[model samples]
Target: MQGDVFQADEHGPAEQPGERLLLDLDGFEGPLDVLLALAREQKVDLAKLSILKLADQYLEFVARVRQHHLDLAAEYLVMAAWLAYLKSRLLLPEPEPEPGEQPTAAEMAEILAFRLRRLEAMQSAGTALMVRPQLGRHFFARGEPEGIVVVTRSLYDVQLFDLLKAYADHVVRTSVRTLHIEAPDLYSVEDALRRLERMLGRMPDWSVLSSYLPAILGDPLKMKSAIASTFIAALELAKQGRVQLRQDGGPYSPIYIKAGGVAA
Candidate 1:
């Protein structure tokens, strides 16, 4: 039954010398064009034509074309194998479909039809493109010749050392600097200790350490240094058991000092 289906029709219409069909099977253009022509003869739409039904006719056409042009049968054979595979897929029973399965015969046929339609559209577009005028060969731009204009200018090739020297000179000219001389601190810790002793002898009772600071120091900056020196001297006298230091309130409270180590 399969052999009968694939067998060529011996009684089909014969071709005359003047009416021979022009086919370029070597170029592989004949297969698709022949199939389209056959579909048109059956009054069937190219997209809806059953690949299974046309399979036999297409194979027969390829076999006959092969007999006339042996050298050109390679592409035709490949196309035949593809159609034969499609035919077998349609005839054979398919397994139960799982997720992410291959496309069915109907889907494959639709895809083939879409591809054929796209191929036809691309071929038409290609033909239209070939027919249009080409640049530099057919069409040309119209413009006047703007002759070359050359204007020479001078250029200096200065060295990196020269650039550095210029930068240093510019910086020296633009920069402003003032000379500062800081005098040495003449007040000593011994001086601070003696001053504290004299102040305590005058008071001789519990007094805030801030009260020991002079009523008039020379300047605010000098007074800051003097206060620091006095505080250091008080710490030394406390260490020596010569003075008693106490804070009646919290840590941040004023420190009270007296002449003797024994608290009153």
Candidate 2:
């Protein structure tokens, strides 16, 4: 079924042209991505670059992606709006600061810095996923019992960028209509995680996991920030060998957290 789907995609109207999805030494996801890529590729100052041409490219890129990938265009539109808004403002005449209010260069830098940070994160995940060998489990209908598979530390490491992307993707999921069940309040988990985040932490109990989240946020659009923020904090603790996530089996398994980090 999987092969058949791929074959259909290969020959189907949706088939991407050979040159499509291909990244040049610097061809980027969008104008912001392109600027960031160029900055990295050239190893030049991120500031002082002309935003005019880049802003135009940003608009053009959105239109191009829409023609090729409708789904991508929807998500890219958010970035497009941000660029267009910035471009429009930059085109306006400078206004005098009223009284003691001055917009510092640092503020402008931060506005542009977000794109650079996010692009780096996106690139790292793309590289990591590209290197991992494909597992054919989806190609088969069933799997025979096999020996335990062990993965060493070298195999895969998740990054904060990936966590943000995943959380964004998760938030974008459609909300469930069914009632949510949990023994504890979500604010409690948020408090716990936030507290644990400040000090290196441990794995959380698997059961009642929903308590860690706002039940109403089962939908995608609302879950991104909270979940993504939680995700990286957990992993940061794990990286220092200060925290470990433990899951007990069956109904007896107690899902609890522990601290792990250089300090732990």
Candidate 3:
């Protein structure tokens, strides 16, 4: 029913054997499609199709195509080779397994059947989806104007710069002065030494160095000058035995200048 009678092989007709009728397959997508068509015509289940017979049919079909000198796709030839390999592997005797070991699961017929079943499942799914309702086909969406919210402005409203200037004025008025205002740097080391001597002469003999520093150094600038001058004066006084400077803690600790034999 599928193809005209050309010749007969050992099997009565192309449809009688494990193979299918010799139909023109130039329009078929691939070998699988041809196989599926044959299975459908013969009312055979793809999962239960005979692997050896199927391979034989495919090779026979290829030979017929070659005989007719029809232009063949490389994929068809490749499928022919694969079927030949499957036929050989299926016909071969199973190898004996070692003791306590199972045989390999790489059987050719099982793999081909599994793949064919999967293809059939996919084809059925595609057919079902083709009849289902799709978007932009069965129904159309309503169209409406996109609404945009806009705000109205008044002529009396203040601008961005006005708000910024108000904030700046508030900051300047409420800010506390952290800067230390000090006297000029007119006094030299000698001037500082003289000022320290006057303060020391009036204080006790063992007065703390830090106690007299505040009185001798009037401001931050004077304090800077007095520190350098006082260090030199203390060194000189200690060298001359007029005063002794001793620390209360470790390095960089508080120092106390005590009067020695000398008066001031």
Candidate 4:
């Protein structure tokens, strides 16, 4: 009875098995699934393909299937009912909406379309998962087989006296003998003073302290100790007024020395 109200076109081409089910109109010939997808994606003009016409075609399809004595699926009937309800809602005049009120007919249609698209996406994902290679069936994990391991440990039994004896022997073998040899004092302050006095007696004019050093000491190894002792001796002689010390340039310049009023 519902099919009679929304019947298919008698002049349309005959349906064939294993062929895509399409809604054949005067200017449009496409599957309803494709139309819904285009609508959801906003790729096609909804004004060109009317919703009322789509619902009519779907009902007509149901009618055609019934004519062939084929049992209709529950989902087909559900979709037909939904299409009819959507059509009625779209056709009727909408009332003014209040604040925080229910959605309008157009909004409800958009929500339904969104839900259908989500369902389609879930189905596509499920199909992809089903076709993917499963573990153990397609391929097995590669790994080396487990094996038993054997470990050998060595133990030594000894007495306290033997342990002490071994420790004493190790210490005796590794112990180092440190010899401290005392180096004799090769040069002294008194010797440096005696030498400087003898040199000053011969040279009456001012001369650099370095000139006096070569006459007093010669060994390179004793140079550091000799220089230190000579400087100390010079200071003592200066304090005693035996020699005069002066630097013409700056603090870092060579020390100029001459015999003072007191002869050393």
Candidate 5:
């Protein structure tokens, strides 16, 4: 059933797009919700609307809902009772006031009107937000870059930690035990190079660099001389196409020396 007061103007032949023949109270959240909707539709100021006759309209709407056997909530009934009380209070004449006494009827009406205004404002904001374009709905984020593939390290790459560990091991292995003698002994890179050549002749085709630097495990002076000679010898061999040096896996991996042509 339709409400008489809630019905749109029918004086004009054509009705507006949002104009409805009946008030759909079911669309509202509560009694205040219905009042807010009605006030917004009519563009009525909440504070001024209390002075005008709106209590009867509100009560009639609630009564109609109850008459239709529609399940009305307790809030709706409570609001109806409050509206009846407000109406009665408005009708009665004002009593003689004591000093600084409360203005019950006007204050009550103002408070109710203020609350209704706030509710109406929030409803308007919510409705506006519902219509706005959202992040995922209106526009989507761009997919991550698929073209570029980053490689952190390549095969046989020597990381810093591995290099440091290998150096530390080399230091420990090259440390010499002290031996006292009357005469001081001297070592040379040439002596180390000749020794390395003889060792390589007896060794396999491909051997680790340590195999040619056995002096590192003995005297510290010999170890330094052998290291210098080994570097020069390797360079000379590579130039003459006599030896090839390689390091496989990480930095901790042995430096393998192979006969480029034939070992010197």
Candidate 6:
């Protein structure tokens, strides 16, 4: 889970009453993951996830954790604090960032440097990949460069990924739903996968899995489901000694095929 939220009083026994049924916000990947789970749980408008209240509560919860647990969470706590800070700034009616503050030279230089590094790394990676017949491929022919475009934009073009910080902001202003109340299960992997296959007109590569899910489910969710369901089901069946997931097929990845399911 990502930037999720919960009041401190809500989590307890870590299992029996309020546990397992809902994800623990503290167990999230980031503030956004936590926010996404809350949005889905509350059925918040797909357009937004309350970020301010969530970020505030996140920091509060971090402070309240067992003294010992704080050490384990120091890094996460730091990030949570940052989210809360960023959220507060957004709530105020302000013109905008200071003129010079717009992508400071350091930030711009860093971004450019990062892009250059990526290009170089891509070249090196491409070369290394070509050493193995299974890995080599070029979407553009050798010595051909791809076109790049630059664009100016505002937040409306944002995808779910862009909302992590946004969610942290709204969470403070609007209450974040706690999983204290019961919510009926929505999509189980069992049903979700079936729906996905139907949506795609076929079972698809793990990468394509999320495209069939709700936008809130998002691309990252689909990628995760692909990796999880494929491996988990394969593992279960493998224990029964029936099938195994093999990744011998280039970029297509592994599948659980019966011991004799495929013949070379």
lDDT for each of the candidates?
A: 0.70, 0.53, 0.67, 0.67, 0.68, 0.48
Candidate 2's residue-wise lDDT over 1-264, tens digit each?
Answer: 011111111122345445334322123444456557545654544455555555677677557545544444333467677667777767776676677875543355466766676677888999999777666743443467677989777665799999999888788785535797865323333554575566442334232322344444455644555455455555555565756655556765544446542322
Q: How many residue pairs clash in each candidate?
A: 0, 11, 0, 0, 0, 26
lDDT of 5 by residue, 101-202 (tens): 876887788887888889978878999999998889998777875687887975777899999999999998888668877753545657666765676556
Tell me how far candidate 5 lies from the true structure as C-alpha RMSD in angstroms: 22.3
lDDT by residue for model 4 over 1-264, one digit each (tens)? 222112224453345443333333322222335336535454544444456666776777667655643434444567788778888989999888799987787886766556546656765898999999998999787688778699989897999999999999999988968888999655688888998888767765888887777443456557766777888889998999989887789777998788876433
**Model 4 lDDT on a 0 to 1 scale:** 0.67
Cα lDDT of model 1 overall? 0.70
The alpha-carbon root-mean-square deviation between model 1 and the true structure, to one decimal in Å, is: 17.8
TM-score of each: 0.38, 0.30, 0.39, 0.33, 0.43, 0.26
lDDT of 1 by residue, 40-141 (tens): 566777677778877778888777865654433344567688888888888988778889998987777777667666766777899999999988889976
* Over 4 Å off, model 3: 1-26, 97-106, 143-264
Q: Please give the range of 10 consecutive residues that has the lowest summed lDDT in model 4.
A: 1-10
Query: Candidate 1, TM-score vs. the true structure?
Result: 0.38
Score candidate 5 by lDDT. 0.68
What tens-digit string does per-residue lDDT give for candidate 3 at 163-196? 9999999999889678888766644657656656
**Which residues of candidate 5, in runs, are more than 4 Å off?**
1-25, 99-103, 145-264
TM-score of 6: 0.26
Residue 127 of candidate 3: its Cα lDDT? 96
Residue 176 in candidate 1, Cα distance off native in Å: 15
Q: Pick out the ten consecutive residues of candidate 1 with the lowest summed lDDT.
A: 1-10
Greater-lDDT candidate between 3 and 5: 5
Question: Which candidate leads the pack in lDDT?
Answer: 1
Name the 10 consecutive residues with the lowest summed lDDT in model 3.
Answer: 1-10
